[model samples]
Target chain A: MTGKDDVATLEEELPLVELPLDAWHRAKGARMVGFAGYHMPIQYEGIMAEHAWTREHAGLFDVSHMGQLGFSGEGVDEALEVLLPSDIKGLKPFRQRYSMLLDEEGGILDDLMVSRLGDGAFDGAEIYMVVNGATKYDDIGWMIEHLPDEVVMNHMDEQALLALQGPEAGDAMAALVPGTAELLFMQSGLFTWRGVPLWISRSGYTGEDGFEISVPADSVQLLADALCALPQVKPVGLGARDSLRLEAGLPLYGHDLDSRVSTIGADLGFAIQKRRREEGGFIGHARVLKELADGPGTKRVGLTIEGRLPAREGAQIYSGANLVGEVTSGGFAPTVGAPIAMGWVSLPHAALGTALEIEVRGKRIGATVAPMPFVPHRYRRAKS
Target chain B: MSRYFTDEHEWIDVAGEIATVGITDYAQEQLGDIVFVELPAEGAVFEKGDDAAVVESVKAASDVYAPISGEVVEANGALEDEPALVNSDPEEDGWFFKLRVADASELDGLMDEAAYKKFVASL
Candidate 1:
């Protein structure tokens, strides 16, 4: 739903696959759609209501379609640094970093969360990572082709991913997994509930304090039911997931961060550590450094739409009749109570408060470049 | 006066030369929450199968096509503020626009209520 934009390419000849909790989702009255080759739920109650629920309370999301990979063996850190711009060697145990897999030309292939497990844990895995659902196959193939044989990449195909996110997420998680509330932002740990092993991270894409729990596929239903039964928890679907992330100003994979886009132009230079930027040893390092030294011509920015109508993907943006860029992702922001959009624009037009125009249905509507993260991120950095 | 339905899920209530057009209940349901609707202006002429109106949900936007060639007589002003009316009463007050029928013969190609019900069931 986030990274994939190729709905027309869905191979109707190929049968859609069901997730581990497919029956449970149907029983809960989820409106399912074929997304990323899986019959994933688009909404439960409705997109607006579900979006509001996640901003006020806890909402559960089934993200099992994503590919989970584990890497182990000596020299794994040094090997991973060769593919990513992040300083993988400096990653502390139980901490995670946001990084991207870059093509040799410096374009991003996929964005991922890489977490180093506590020393000598999870049998042999020194690092565990989660990649976008649609690009996981290619991401794994890229790593297998590049990673040295000493580092063994294990694909956790039999596991399911669940994200419990929002303001009340801490309370709901604490009720089920007692120690989860103590985990700070970007930290992860191994835990057990009813003897089912879980690898949970205190992180999410919703710009809220939450946890992404990885559990055995067979026992996901039991885990989901337990969480949903809590007072503040409800099952949400991909519809809300997208709207929430958009409000948080996070980019979707296929729409905003395609293979042709660079990390510098995407305004994601924070992912590269200071040491890595100066050292320049990772893939596409030359281009990244050049772009860093000399600013990118076009930069990604947020837009505040003037009218009620939403400017969706591919809508043309203009600066007084001269086309500047196109909208990447946009919709009615339920929480912000206005129409907001994100797109890439020319450097001159990308400044905050710069007035612009968006042609929706041939009528030009007024818009202005605004600061991102339209909704303030409420991440809990430490135990309160 | 008889009611006709199109495969695209639009319904037309034919009364003499004026035809009341609206999407079926199934379509409003399928579209989920109706947030915005772009109704064609009065006097706008549309050919059969031309894009008549636009409907937007929280997730995506879709086009409502004309079932028969006609000129728009009036659009439902009530929907400009209360788009959810399409979800609540799609057959009655949720009507999109009134089209002054260009050719009554086009009605013969459309399915009746009974046929539309069966067509929907087949889907």
Candidate 2:
């Protein structure tokens, strides 16, 4: 089976979301590759150039293929609580929470964003969520089986998502929407630009201050073109997005957190809310809570290689002579100007400042376990 | 003077006893943004078409082969820090090593620039 198909089989089956600029990507000489079921641009110019461009300026990305769903009706929070370990009922409006879709065995199926949408003109008491593109259909399938009939889940397939990221992203976005800079990190609100309604979220996978604008699919091309026309924004592809996330020390769903890995072992214990830890009602809550109270046997950690050579995913990680762990994600970090990686290692060796080594093509290259966010995050937050 | 190429895309230029070895420009482009080069230790002997060095790119790693049987006389230490030189000047500054040609007749069996170009196109 093809790599994409292998992932597709593991996910809950759902329809694929096509972005507005799908044609534009093909016309730009982008190499369309299957990712998360959608034909996405892997590269346009080149991986290196695209990676550097995103780090220096702004990259306009079409992430509309990701699943965007909304839930409403009575006891929506309580119903969601049965599936996720996060305290969704306590989430305030306009605020977004990062949580995982876990299996009964305490393994992560997917990581998703859940936001409480306040009462709107059309709907009252709703919850909006965006899930990973590859696992969205499976995530929806899992939710359907668990959600009570009263809670209606509406798939926002009519919408398109765009991410504009980099240091100059805010300035460029502000010029278009005028007040987008006021949205703090992880906060979303409805706004209109030139009469096009948009749900703008101040967040991104890259460790840059950026916004994810969800707009009607029909108007996606116009919005993307408008953003690209700005001096700071350039069309970026999947190649740079992968490299940028690697540099940011963020996890890729399949490679980093999979059905085989528990949330605590993946260094995502912080995502489990304190109330959930105590109430212990969600799926896999017993194992997760126990691991939280004690600790996981292995943990994910950041790694820095000694030289220019990069350690790719699946490379063996070692502590001196012993095989301790394996590299989950790794690459040449564009922002750090060197090679960096994230891998899971034995709990004792996963701590920051711990030294380790990776065997690359038979040679044991020296590495050190370091703190995550290898580059400090520059996300835009509200001033105190 | 004679020119030879191995299946791995490495080319050798031989004159009497001394031989110059480097990867073809096509090979450099395929590898893309070479980050590391592991050259053979000087004085190491190899038969024709034997793996001699390694060139690593951001996407993958490739092995360089000996186009003609020889003993490594010198290596490119500069590539340890600036492997991009291979992409920039594959024929000149990016030459991997120099060797003492062990079997002069091996050079006769390899391809010239025109033949090598045609061979690459076939791929």
Candidate 3:
């Protein structure tokens, strides 16, 4: 969020890398900022304008900075279970699930999306994973060092990731690739367009019905241009992307989540499959089970401030004069027309409607714990 | 009346002992969209370079520093209802507040219009 191009490698003096769409974003007058290790477009037209566009129309986002990886060969699921708590072995082909990578102490290393690639796409590749851009190198190295030698790990660094999200996303995607509207949320496939492979998932972080298209680096501009040409799609920047995810109550890797945060305290218990919870085989399983049995010491909760001022990250949460917790992510919610935040607090002070105070710029602002997803999710779930 | 600019992108139009303050067009443009404006209460005293106001956009919030030591005389309450004014007409009706200047000499230290233009170009 600072002026530095990349904080992750700031001390190392490594150069800030650019995405394949760097020129394209600049052409659109995007205001680029240093995020993770990449120079990403924070906004173009404007944040409020782009945020409203995504809520009403289709907004295209360049998330190629995320690390796209593939794992294949025998015993892939068994090997993956050692790191992730999700039900990887039971994942149906072309289906995706949300999961987290945990440390030996049960603290989260990173949150990720794991999808089982359909057999029709690649004959050998079995599992597809996407990790945060900042932690990807370490994730790859960790997997390489831990997994059996028979399993092959492929980093699809040559690809660009794009998210076309909003209510009209289905219409925009179906315009380019027919039958895309039929894909339900969490479903994915390898579709061909203009003779190029497009790995698409009917899912996104905005809590909207949308598609995340993964295309070859060279073909990305073409695909982006085609999508933007549609009446429903417009290029959105990281500014709106962050606001949308904030409203959706989704946690960001380095902000809302970190190495010291457990899955339970992070409010990500859903990522742990029931079978994994009962069997207790994954890394940090004992700690997670202990929290599940005797609640976490602290828990993540949502806060709605009483005034217009935002209580940004690092703001302390106070109940009377006692410090209870600290805010991880907070900002004005464009959709809700108020300020919203997510933070971790002791279990006793984490209840909904618990009145608390957040100190912003040395002033205490009245706030209360509220239900999350300030804007209800509009995903296209499977037909019941 | 003459206008003075600060390195932080704040502008103060001084007339005798009173100064009208607001952010420059460049600051508003850099901020993207202005959703909320936090103004200091009337009669509030501030030192030169103290954070006197805050402007928040959808992406992030930024503090507006006082260009000179002064006591806030009036706050633009219009901003509370329509903060977008700061984005539309930043120099005029979008002014943030009025201050009773504590020392008129502080205005001499600020950049003039031409100097500020050159300074901004350097950034």
Give the candidate number with the greatest DockQ: 3
What global local distance difference test value does model 1 have?
0.90
Least well predicted 10-residue stretch by lDDT in candidate 1 chain A: A1-10
Model 3 segments beyond 4 Å from truth?
A1-13, A120-123
Candidate numbers, best TM-score first, in rank order: 3, 1, 2
**Which residue pairs in candidate 2 have backbone atoms (N, alpha carbon, C) closer than 3 angstroms, thus clashing?**
A12-A137, A12-A138, A64-A161
**Candidate 2 chain A lDDT trough over 10 residues, lowest sum:** A1-10
What is the docking quality class of candidate 2? Answer: incorrect
Provide C-alpha RMSD values for all models, in order: 2.6, 4.1, 2.2
Docking class of 3: acceptable
**Candidate 3 chain A — worst ten consecutive residues by lDDT sum?**
A1-10
Candidates' TM-scores?
Answer: 0.95, 0.88, 0.96
Model 2 misses residue A173 by how many Å?
1.0
Ranking by DockQ: 3, 1, 2
lDDT of 1 by residue, A31-144 (tens): 888877788988899888999999999999999999999999889999999999998999998999999999999999999999999744456599999999888999999999
The sequence of per-residue lDDT tens digits that candidate 3 reaches over residues B1-123 is 999999888889999889999999998998878788989999999999888888887666778888899999999999999999999999999999999999888888899999999999999
Candidate 2 stretches with Cα past 4 Å from truth are A1-20, A118-125, B1-21, B24-27, B44-51, B64-71, B98-123
